[model samples]
Target: MTSREQPSRKRPRSEDASLKNSLSDSERETHEDLIFIRPMRPLSVEPDRDDKFWYKDGNVVLVAGNVAFRVYRGLLASQSTVLDDLCSADPAWHVDGCPVVHMSDRAEEVRSLLSVLINGKTYITKREVSFEDLAIWIRLAHKYRIADLLENSLRRPSLQSPHHSITAVNLARLTETSSILPLALYDCCQLPVETLLNGHTYPGGRVEKLSADDVQRCIQALSVLGVQRTLAIVKSMDLSACGYSCRFECADHVSAIKTELLEDLKSPGCRHPLCSWARFMGQYNRDMTSNVKNSAHPMCPRCIKTVIQSHGQVLLECWKNLPELLGIEVEGWATAQDA
Candidate 1:
């Protein structure tokens, strides 16, 4: 049994890499004894060997979809005890003198998993991993009991990505990746209802959808979040009395801000009112560059002193109640700061 040494987890690594969408050189390579084929090109039931993963000295043939990877059994056995059992149990099924293990996963998924196992390009180490791709990796990792791979794949996804939509909440539910749920659901609430129902578009315009149950959850959660948004607005709406009462601009701006906040409640999405509000006139909306990010109501020193103080507390409290709002109970789920 040939083996490849696993990489050190403590090693300092940087520069995230992405899953390659297309092969660099020729998608296929020919050899006297072996021929390598890129997956998803479609092949016969017998399947074709992978262009990148085939090794001349491999002891096992792992078939996934219509593609195969001829790789060392010991290398896999070293990573996952579950894989070790599978590779050894089916010795009676052999291909070209190497034992065959047929997998139900898609060829592309197997390719990604093998790449991560062999190349050390994991979700955390990768520069950017889309939620869809990460979901796939996680499913495979769980199926195979690949502890390291599952641990890395389970790291919090980039909720800030526009493509991070309701699909994430659904995936989190399906994969039992609960830590991702609270924020993922919160992020979904920020989208317009049409967008939430239809889902966000990736670079290729691939739109992920939500399950009916999740759709219902989000709708219910949005209504609850809307109340939170209202409370935040009401908390700050009384800023006119803070020594700036003599200034008519303060009253005028407060009125304008109140109207905008009220409109947010009527809007089709979660306004994220607290996070978006600043100590300045960010609610009043004057100028972008000059107004400063998360600006306060103008010339109101009291607002400057206490706006974030109140909003930050509200944001934390909102996050604390998130799992309950979504109505999903996760084992050992704990609330984090402003998730």
Candidate 2:
């Protein structure tokens, strides 16, 4: 066979010299850029009598540059000052006046200013955010890319108190808006059902008038949004005080939720530790010889089929009476109104 053209002496290894040289140059440039840029962002500068920047809309500092913003500690304590600043129609030397300027080149400076504004405040001061003020500040921050400041401000602990009624309008305004804080998710999950059902209505119906379809939608929405913990919290709510109001308005949801829960229980690895004791105390027995959660003998499929073909009331009655017949100790299930 004609010898395949003797593989030309394998080209000697290139040693990645070109790649190594290019990478070294790139890394050097990046390091130089960071070193040069970081210091341009000053943490603090004395405000001149004719300061170029001014506080507008709470903590935001508006300067004459590309959508630049900063936070100021002293201005946050006064609402009137914030309002007056935002109302300034012709704020010279302010970002609002020169909104078209491109400040993307000075990102480091903006970060430094924001760090100064937010970090300067004490934890107690930050926690005192009202809904309206927070709404305004978050809007400005998002517009200017104040990611760190937004995180710090909204991460402050909040309690489930009636302090939200005053800010209802603001909360409603920001719904589904990207201008909202990431922590707003926490607030949404924490909001009282009473507050939600109230739905911008005051001095009237508290529990939302949920129809069958509305209940299905809310359940699906909550599931899709991955708020399982919140759903569990909702599941645990005690609605006994409202009596018929709760029964009529919330029954379908409650029943559907329980049905889903029972299916979940039937799945593998769904054993709820806290409810295990309660579950064990309610197991059905065939020969009436089982003690509790565990049954001594399994029943025929015909018995199961007959039970499945019954109404909710009949099923509940059978459940309640199962423990009695089989000598299991089960606390009778309470009604939706009692939940």
Candidate 3:
């Protein structure tokens, strides 16, 4: 019952192994050329290896610290314009490095290019960047439509630098109409005068927050509130009588901030006509009247209206201007008019 042993068949080899041996000598040489080529890994703290990481998914390549050649090598060889642009030094002498290379998270240009590479778009940025190069980056980011970057820039705590005082002053001047945050803007009245002067180029620019002697400073600073409407806020707070009458110079300077100082007239029930007179003088300009074309005069009718509408003290205080209305001699008028 012993049958002839069946001839054993050769087992199939793995495709990888068979394919390896299938090449002729020269073909085998070419097979070695088929070595797996991965993309160069993004530079990091990790050690480098010959086996590169391929980026077939097409990501925004973030190449940092002298890796331009590697990044360029991976893509199809061209005239090398993109690589050259990245490698060249910044044309603006203001920037310290090639903003395109060694992409620091701090570099605005690199941040921008990185955003475009990864997110397929740009951003607007102008944060508290102190460095000239970073500032350029912020400007470019702003130009390129990177909104998040711009917001991030704005949200950054303002830098404290030797030139920050000057920068803050200039920023305030520039933002007088732009609605950007005011430089030394909030409670600048409380900052030290020496600090403000040493930091900024503002010759006569006084920081109000630090010095208490600056009533005019407060008025001037408050006048620049274009970004924030302060009328209602000012009206809500109780204002003390400014004792300019005691100081001859202070009384004379009253005309300088007549418009802003007029808010004092919004008192609850103080009807001294002199106060109303001063208030009327504050806003009663012929130019304003001409612009609005109200038939009733701003001073005569409005002043009386304010008197009638207010509580008893405010009414009496408003009517106190009555003697002045008829050109009668009021003793204080002699001094104030003389002033």
Candidate whose TM-score is highest: 1
RMSD of 3: 25.6
Ranking the candidates on lDDT from highest down gives 1, 2, 3
Model 3 regions lying over 4 Å from their true place: 1-137, 140-177, 181-189, 200-339
* Per-residue C-alpha lDDT of model 2 across residues 225-297, encoded as one tens digit per residue: 3333223324332233323342122333334444655566544334221121222212332334554512432
TM-score of 2: 0.24
| Winning model by lDDT | 1
Q: Which ten residues in a row have the lowest lDDT in candidate 2?
A: 272-281
Lowest lDDT sum, 10 consecutive residues, model 1, at 28-37
TM-score of each: 0.68, 0.24, 0.24
Candidate 3 has what TM-score?
Answer: 0.24
Candidate number with the higher lDDT (1 or 3):
1
Summarize candidate 1's per-residue lDDT along 72-160 as a digit string, tens digits: 88778877755665565424356788988766667877887887778764335756765666777777677666777777778735434
